[model samples]
Target chain A: MNDPGRRLPSGSEPVPDPADGPTDGPAGGLTGARSSDRTRAAILRAARAHFARHGYERTTIRAVAADAAIDASMVMRYFGSKENLFDAALTIDLRLPDLAAVARDDLPRVLVRHFLDRWEGDPADDALLLLLRSAVTHERAAERMREIFAEQVAPALGEAVDPRRAGLVSAQLLGLALTRYLLRAPGVTALTPDEVTELYAPALAAVLS
Target chain B: MNDPGRRLPSGSEPVPDPADGPTDGPAGGLTGARSSDRTRAAILRAARAHFARHGYERTTIRAVAADAAIDASMVMRYFGSKENLFDAALTIDLRLPDLAAVARDDLPRVLVRHFLDRWEGDPADDALLLLLRSAVTHERAAERMREIFAEQVAPALGEAVDPRRAGLVSAQLLGLALTRYLLRAPGVTALTPDEVTELYAPALAAVLS
Candidate 1:
């Protein structure tokens, strides 16, 4: 039920009609960059949905292309191979709140709240679930997860606390995602976000300290 | 290298030769039950390795049979399908400590340590990781995980704690397994089991309380 129109990259491109699909035809010259960008975004959106549902190993280029309403060759031309496509599909910006700016006492609560908001905010669009879901199924996806922890998570929290335990923080958050979002475990999914914050924020604070 | 001899069902039946493979011939009469058990166990072990590495959606009956030293037909004959095989492969007993017998103050620590022991005791043999790893890729595996949480984890801890929070406790523990065991996140994997208990047990206790 995804709107292809809404999946377009935010830019100066002339927005295509919602019913026309991506762009009218093969792109060229002035419209080429815009058309390609829209195509890539559409492909990434489809790819993330597949990876989230089918996981890294089972998700196929053909399936992703079919979902994107493009030819399989187009997906290949843009993203190269399945592995590269996977990497492109799940490149997430955690948009971690500026931890350095938070009051020292507020860091744990803020971090926990930010994560919950990010996961619950727009689940269908978030690539983190796709990454986590695929991580267990493929080594490359797992490595990508490790990279996100090292690059995004660690640096984001490093100034406020011992960066090393960022992995632990990620573990707690990812585990919650695994249960609440992906597995939809009854007890976990049943909790409201406020309840999650009340119950989980403390554990995150404990790990940080 | 798995020894088929070691995989046999523990019973009065004579063990097979590791050198000779599973058994001498088609089992009938008295050896039937034992032979079948050995074959099933062998299949499960291979299936776990595959599920651990490949995720559920991608693991095939053919591949599992090849690894188990049997014909693909035999695997189907016993397990019926990939989904059934996945169910059989990942059926884990958390072997929770007797929470009812422990002092109330020690419940959290005891539970955390038991999970660590279970995970680290014989990692190759532990199906919990396999279950978690595959749970995201397929609905059946995810349901199986939910089943384990409901049946095994909730009941085991129901006596000492509010059983409903069992899912939260499981979330924390499962998160640790995701980063430390499955993803092998360096910061987390570097922690000694005691350190994990020290850092994480507090969160679980907080959730429980």
Candidate 2:
């Protein structure tokens, strides 16, 4: 448990401390204490909320500390700074399916389907939304969003397609996510996940081929 | 010239004060100077800069007023509120090409070519980027972005394609904007406008057909 005396931020009511509550360590002994794991989880959850809801600039360490019911100093001890926390919070692996393993003729459909599924499965799984939201307003956020797509999603897919064409495929696929997920275009969001997969698969196949 | 009597947030330095320098109005004409035109222009310029740079919430009215060298009260006098100012600032007419005039088989190419041209033409012409950047953190921004696409782009294209199929076009075209322009994915941005037109046109034709 953290030092209990710290005053939290305004507008947030502190829940019963999780360590002292049902999610607590086994009551038998101190050796069962997993305070470190609990603390990390708390910080991550709070950080994600802050980033997703208030964006990067509005999300301060003091605000996050208050939300997590932990000391502000404890947050710094764990994550170093707001930038470090943001880096950790935004570190998500999209886990896109292996396109090379898909049938060549069905590649577009498969890719589209996979992407639609990922998009529809969870609205909250949107790090892109968080990034897009922040990027519009902040230079650092824009730089980071670009860097992640370049370093992570593009390189992995570029391995399957020719490296030269990877950017095109990445652009289309990421664009699908942006329109369908973040923008929530009625035209984009209205499609059933299956319909999206069906319609866009051939397009994906064309890009890959 | 801006009234030096105004107070503004100290932490917001990236926002420049566009309202502060010398003005053409008479010295005693602060209230009735017809300087509202200048004030309105400054507000628009400041709004675009703030919305383009930081998005909605962080781009405070006070920050914009400071940037415009006007008092926050002047912004309220002209635009009513931040939400109204954002609506005015983000308004855009897509002015899509006449797809109906193109040869049937060549429609996709035409569509893709047009999209690529517009998407790449000016990074700042994007109302979508403005919305995306502000949406994650601000619900109003999200709603407005959704409304624009649903009301403007979708209706125009929905007339050409099946209502059901039109959304796919929205998804594809918008996806291009999100990935290529906003996200700045290397693979996405690397494609020449012509290549994108070539690659995407057939798919677009299919949707229409």
Candidate 3:
């Protein structure tokens, strides 16, 4: 579900400078709040890396905590059990662009480019790949994956095509991601990012139109 | 990498039926050969089903033997070991149509139709699905999958397009199979086969052309 190799930012929470004391006033409260947020974000990033690399059954909260450089007890206190941690870590935002705003013909190229960028932008940080890897074996992950596609992707492509057709578009795009990134199927991986976009854009365009 | 659930024909090698002596003539030899072939096929089928359902790590020789209704010794005697049995069972024949013979414009529709028919034809008997399920976790299975795509699929489509483009085509098609069949992603699986064909064929056509 998550890969452990990716490094999380050091120092789970930013420490307040000794010079800035309680006399620092309202800024102190904001800094404290921000520190808690940073800790949570760090835990989540570490958790995702573990899940992406090891999968649901094998990934342990302790390992995630170790990777995040936090105490295991802190992880448990913040996220409860491993399952809860996984649920928190894998909250995906596809961030599908608004198709309505783009020219109809430009949709396919836009969509392909966006996905290629997402996948190439960062391999270890990609939550979608985590879900894809885990969904194959874990029932909960599979359900989450289904929910993401149905709720986020389908709505984003609304009225550009029928719901069913939109689903097909998703299948095509996801397939490319699975082969290129997750499976590293040689042929698919051999192509440069631009080459992939060149080859896939038209096919996606056909689907969109 | 292989499942034991799909039935292989019984008998890995032909044995002369005890009822028919070697002296019984050519007819006796033919019947014995056919029986052995059937047994071998039965064992392979069972192996595929088991691997597909349980994955490489969990699938066992005894379970495959039990599913085939053959003695454990017989399973070993035929396929040697669990790993060897897996290799034997998952030898896929995609039976990709002769693309060179097909009209270039019709290639996409033909290719999509063939795969849809193959997947929908018999979910239980499909070796491809077994390989796909196993490939995610098992390095050996994953390697086999890569080899199959590179050797069988890439070569089949070679004359029609560049090898790199053929690989991209494989990614798209395999991705569809991954989401719809393996992950059972809600949106992709909901479509009827015809609906899928309608949506996917054009995209594939664009790739092929």
True contacts kept of each: 0.71, 0.56, 0.71
Query: For candidate 2, what is the lDDT?
Result: 0.61
Ranking by lDDT: 1, 3, 2
B48-112 per-residue lDDT for model 3 (tens digits): 77777667668898988887788989888888899898887667777788877888787787888
Ranking by TM-score: 3, 1, 2
Lowest lDDT block of 10, candidate 1 chain B: B2-11
Fraction of native Cα-Cα interface contacts (under 8 Å, chains A and B) also present in model 2? 0.56
What DockQ does candidate 2 score? 0.37
In CAPRI terms, model 2 is classed as: acceptable
Top model number, TM-score = 3
Off by over 4 Å in 1: A1-36, A57-66, A69-74, B1-36, B57-63, B70-77, B123-126
Which segments of model 3 are wrong by more than 4 Å? A1-30, B1-33
A144-181 per-residue lDDT for model 3 (tens digits): 88888888877877664777677778888878876776
Which tens-of-lDDT digit does each residue in B96-130 have in candidate 1?
Answer: 77788877667778888887776765433336767
Instruction: Give the Å shift of residue B93 in candidate 1.
Output: 1.0
For candidate 3, give fnat to 2 decimals: 0.71
